[model samples]
Structures are given as structure tokens and as C-alpha cells.
Target: MTRGVGSMQDTFEKVIKHDELFHEEVLPRLKKLEEVQEEFRVEIGKITASQTSLELTVMKDGQQTRDLLGRFVDHYFGTDDKKLVLKEKVTLKQLSLRAKIALGFIGVLGGSGGILAGVAAVIEILKN
Candidate 1:
């Protein structure tokens, strides 16, 4: 009990003090950290789900968007799948590159006969 700094009793008391400090202070902070960590995990999960869906640019509601820009007004719980999905107020026309290129050519060309007449039919369909 009368020993100096090198005493075993002194080291033991220091250890107990540190332990009490951990229980009183560090434990509660650790608990709050766990809650924040869980929230981050949930947010990362949502981000991962969005990433997966974006790979195909398809929503659970059988609607597709552009692979790059994508489309949506907001997200909602789907009626069928009951999963989070984007609500689309607008649907972009999915056109083939060939059709788009052909349309460009047709736009450049004025009214004509023969082969142009066949293209005119396609243009009529594309216009809508």
C-alpha cells in the first residue's frame, strides 16, 4: 500500500481507471457509432440496388429508360413487385440506330418518288 510508481497496485489502479473511463465514455459513443454505421449500410444498399437496375436501364414495372441519362419523376413502391421503383411520367421512344440514321437521311431529302415513297411510309410511322 506504501509502494511507489513501480508498484503492482498502482498499475492495477490505473487499469481500473481506464476501464471505468471506457465504460462511462467510450461505450456510449461506440453505440451511437454503430447506429450511424447501420444507416450508412442501408444507404449503400439503396445505391447498390440502383446501380444494378441502371446496368440494364430497366425498372421493375417493365418500363425501360435510356442507358445513359435515364428517366424518372420520383421513386415509389411498385404495386406488382412491391419494390422501390422509379415513377416515369415520360417514356422515351426506343429507336434503332439504323432507323435513326435513315430518318436523318430522309429529313435531309425532300419529297421524291420510287424508293423515296417506300421511305415516306416509314417516316409516317416514325413521326408518331
Candidate 2:
């Protein structure tokens, strides 16, 4: 009867140790997994909302019936009308320096005009 009591006590101690190991190790890991899953759920919800907004914009732009991807294909194949003219690809070295110079000139002129307008406005304010 004493040997039986010792065996029962040993079995109970082993069970308690196993329970303690699981509670200390496995429970924390399970909680971490739950937190990661919740973050993933939130990210997926944001992605879904963004997709819905894009779809709404496409529909509003009257491009719903025309497959959005098909437009790209049509443009690539040069099937789109003049309104959807495909852009010409230009290699960097192949570009006309004259065009670059013209663009630069226009930008400088526009910037100077804006500065003059601001100065004129300030002068008018000072005079007033």
C-alpha cells in the first residue's frame, strides 16, 4: 500500500510538470500567433478597402465595361483610338538635346514669371 501511494504521487507530479511546461511555453506562443493573425486581418481589411475604392473610381470613370487590363493591352497593340494614343518609348541617348533645352527654357521662364508676380503683389501691398 505504501508503494502504491508513492507511484500515485509520482504520476501526479509528472502531470503537474507537464501542465506547467505547456502553460508557460505553449500558451505564450498561442497568444503571439493570435496577435499576428489579428494584424494580418487588419492589413487584409485595408487592402480590401483600397481595392473597393479603386473599383468605384474605375466604374465612375466609365471604364467598368471595358476591362481595365484590356485597355493596357489595346494601348500596347496600338488598337486604341487617337484619344488613347500609345506613348513612344525613347532611349536616353536618343533624346533630342533641343527638346531638353526647350523644356528647360520654358521652366525658367515660368518660374521667373511667378517670381515677378509675387514681387508685384508684395510691392502693391507695401504701397497700400
Model 2 spans > 4 angstroms off: 1-6, 63-128
Q: What is the per-residue lDDT of model 1 for residues 2-103, given as tens digits with 9 covering 90 to 100?
A: 899779998999999999999999999999999999999999999999899886564633443343224232322134333322222121135554665566
lDDT of 2 by residue, 1-128 (tens): 46565598789898999999999999999999999999999999999999999989978777655677677777866664543443333442354655544444555467757555455445444554
Candidate 2 weakest ten by summed lDDT: 83-92
In candidate 1, which residue pairs get closer than 3 Å at backbone N, Cα or C atoms, i.e. clash?
A: none
Q: List the candidates' TM-scores in order.
A: 0.40, 0.44
Using lDDT, give the best candidate's number: 2
Model 1 residue 46 CA deviation (Å) reads 0.8
Return model 1's CA RMSD, one decimal.
Answer: 18.3
